[model samples]
Target: AGSSGSRGPSPLTIGMADTIPLAVAFHEIIHSYFRGTEESKCQVKMSGDMMLSFPTGIVGVLANNPNPAKLCFRLKNIHRLDNVLPNKQLISINTMMSTRDTTVVDFNMPALTALLRRQSEKNPTAQYFNVDILKYQIRPKAGAASCPFQLVAYWKCEQDHTDLKVDYKYNLHAMSPPSPLLNVSVCVPMNGEVKNVIAMPKNIWNGENEQALWRFTELSQHSDDRGVGSLRARFELDKGPSSKGTISAQFNCEGATLSGIEFELVGSGYRLSLVKRRFVSGKYICDSEVH
Candidate 1:
């Protein structure tokens, strides 16, 4: 019995040998990844906002290249690109062509807007390009979710419509899975002296910047969309509100990026180690009609 068993130690020994190699291999892989360097990192981020002009099918989009390094981005479901501007330095027209229902644009390093380029002096920190990916759409499609929320806002102003009784109401719908913005704050520029202030769901005031600031604290810490938030206020304006005065807001979500654009590294010998994307609100004007 002992001589027969000596041929091989046991089945347990064989299993241990096989398991050891796999565990060691995984450990080394993780160790090398966490020990990465700057050059080893290859990532892309996209930041932009969506402008919704009510009573119209069009939606305005403003996008800026995320990385400082010269990179190419393939934007899916976008209406158009900034090709007619005649700036070859910021956008590489030759390579950014795609036949599919997608727009590809190569953003050059240190990309500068036309307004910035015209000036003799330029700010290095403010280097960016303005590309209206979706200036207009025939009808807002289902996947057009660059903006996180589908905001339904209403304005009820008397005939005076200025320096008198004014009212504003808004309802923010998450639109997609990136629901419940962690920190939601809507800023409405008073454009005059704001008084007789009143707000719904608490937390609202007239800031020193001459704007009515409404912060949705409960919604900010929400697990899901809380349905709606409303506010009512009366202001004694020294001057009528500016025509350009519109509602601007901040919707920060830890779940997903607001832009709805995804990135993937498509080359060999390089793994997409990490990706970070952020979409901050620029102009969140809500109106009943596109004026």
Candidate 2:
């Protein structure tokens, strides 16, 4: 998710965040009969499975072994910003998972906010963004855990500029890379006409709608033979004073999941199946000023 805010003409601040949930449930027999087993075993299995899809194959465990412990995992290319408004400038992306079995289950997950903070401190580049994460947890019954995570990244810049640009980077080392279909729209102030718009590696252009569409059937992680996909644009100002406009984007990445958390049936003969989904959300508003 990504958003933008303008103090005068150009954007002064940009914000972005992505949230994904990792849920687990075992067969009824396992929950009832394996009650004496240490929760650490489950955590280890879930962590290992989740790391399989990560580019670096690494994740930080913020909390461990609570009745319902919370864990946060950072995703590189799974989630993206769909839309950006210069004046409104706010971004949010989310992926959720759950189980329908009526059986009582014990589970542990991540505290996304705490994990994000710890990640920033460890990475010099990320520290520059001043990112923030918000987390929410809900227990439907006595032993079930449900948590929702939100991460926000923000940057501040100058005010009187005329151009608008955004970039999206994919994790080149992911075990399974994502293929994203993207649609980007920029609203040019009536006072100024669009000068030029560009999408890296090039893409279809719609002058009538002031939009760009990109469909990456296959996107690979950064490597010696392959590179990440990104898009950017520039808007030129017209003769009149600054006016108001908007910039928005939308995209879907298939076969890419955020968390690698999973559950196994410890003592039951019943089979268990896993389902996953991923997507992005946000809008940005652009405003102009007269010099």
Candidate 3:
């Protein structure tokens, strides 16, 4: 056995499955142990050897906003294999939007691969292997309003000469419980300056680069204790009418995956260990209409 050189708490432990001891052992060791002469001995050895040791788990979150419809997906590999890399691994993503209207626009896998390649190239001692998988993207003709859980924005502006009063209304609805933190960023036009901002249920607000950032924590399915979880924000702009600026948002919810991805072990002879993956939304944006 080799040390994985991991620093934190060990995620692996020994337990009993039925009457058998579920212990971690290398593939070669299991194969050698099962090599026997008698039929009964071979059967016993094979049964014991069937237990494979591998680490598998994933944690992720997905976020979206509806000003300039966009999506950002991020994932992490939580498997705890010390020195061994799987022979084959594949990650597949499927969007739940209506196949007729929505399409994937940008996927970051190519950029990620290029980054990894650059790092490996810079460090000659570092070994790298590309996973075999097909990446995809889609474009929605009507934006992300059709998503199961989405944020929709509408703007109203009244202009009196050079002065303007703008009211922003935002609605966030979810069919299922999503991540607890909802991040909203609204871009302010160059000709306009934000005068005041207010949100129901009280949230944190920060301004940078002519954009306002609103953060809502501990969000539930309803906005209040008595109603379904939703959010609304109104912003007042001065100097000019509100322009249709980009609105982007992000959040992480458990038990929901944007891309229905699955993992399987290939050329490993058997299901030697567990392999898990998770997908979450990152920086999802949608277009808004200002009237």
Candidate 4:
């Protein structure tokens, strides 16, 4: 690391030497983040030789930019960028388009409807949902650094003929390593008198808030789309005090109702109110008050 008259390693020279390795590392990190439990062990490691082979290709892409200032701005704003130089900038539009076809041939008993009716009769407390990801696509547009992704989810509600669906499209500029999400699903008994009361299963009701009607404890935690993406939250009678009634629940994903179920309470009645909704940095909605 020889220095010029400045007596320090040249920032420009170090940026050049470090850029290739940094980009390689970033690519490998993306793969690891998407790997699920079944594919946990699968990841491609980049070697120094492999990185060197793409030196010119990487630099060419960076240098050909029409505006150098834009490059610096992009580098600075990168979520994963570092202090020294803009984090390794790797913009490759690898177009990947795949279709998935699934036809559920449910050939059992008289029909799906009849079978579900009989099952519901036997287990009245059970909640049934036939969920499906109706449509999904990752479309790569020409010359765009980020790729556009579309997702649609649908489900059939047997209790009521409610066709739940969610349609959303977004562009992915960069992908980060998969981080675990604190997913919790809990169904606490609703206090009949109080509109909203915080009740802990193991202890007494300590606090009360508009969003504290029903408490939720994390049954499990996982990352976004890492594996078994959607979480199942259910409310049953045995754990709660009420005998049975009905609770109106409207589950919405990105402004679209994915699933809505009105539980027919046999003995007691309960209700849920969504209080505070916070949008994270990436526009991911986090419901703080799901009572």
CA error at residue 160 for candidate 3, angstroms: 7.8
**Cα lDDT, all candidates:** 0.35, 0.27, 0.31, 0.21
* lDDT of candidate 1 over 175-267, digit per residue (tens): 223444546676666654554455553445655777777665435324333443455555544444534255555655433433333332222
Error of 2 at 155 (Å): 14
Off by over 4 Å in 1: 1-146, 156-179, 191-195, 217-225, 234-245, 254-259, 287-291
lDDT of 3 by residue, 62-137 (tens): 1111121121222222121122222222222334521322222222434433434454457544322222223322
- Which structure among the candidates has the greatest lDDT? 1
Give the higher-lDDT candidate: 3 or 4.
3
Q: Name the candidate, 1 or 4, with the larger lDDT value.
A: 1
lDDT of 4 by residue, 172-272 (tens): 33222112212222222232332222222322232352122222221112323422232222222222332222211111112110111011111111111
N/CA/C clash count, model 1: 0
What TM-score would each prediction reach against the true structure?
Answer: 0.41, 0.32, 0.40, 0.20
In candidate 2 the C-alpha lDDT for residue 80 amounts to 21
Candidate 1 vs candidate 3: the TM-score winner is 1
lDDT of 1 at 110: 54
Q: What is the model-wide C-alpha lDDT for candidate 2?
A: 0.27
Model 4 ranges off by over 4 Å: 1-15, 19-191, 194-200, 203-291
Model 2 stretches with alpha carbons more than 4 Å out: 1-164, 172-191, 195-209, 212-215, 222-247, 273-291
156: Cα error in model 3, Å:
1.3
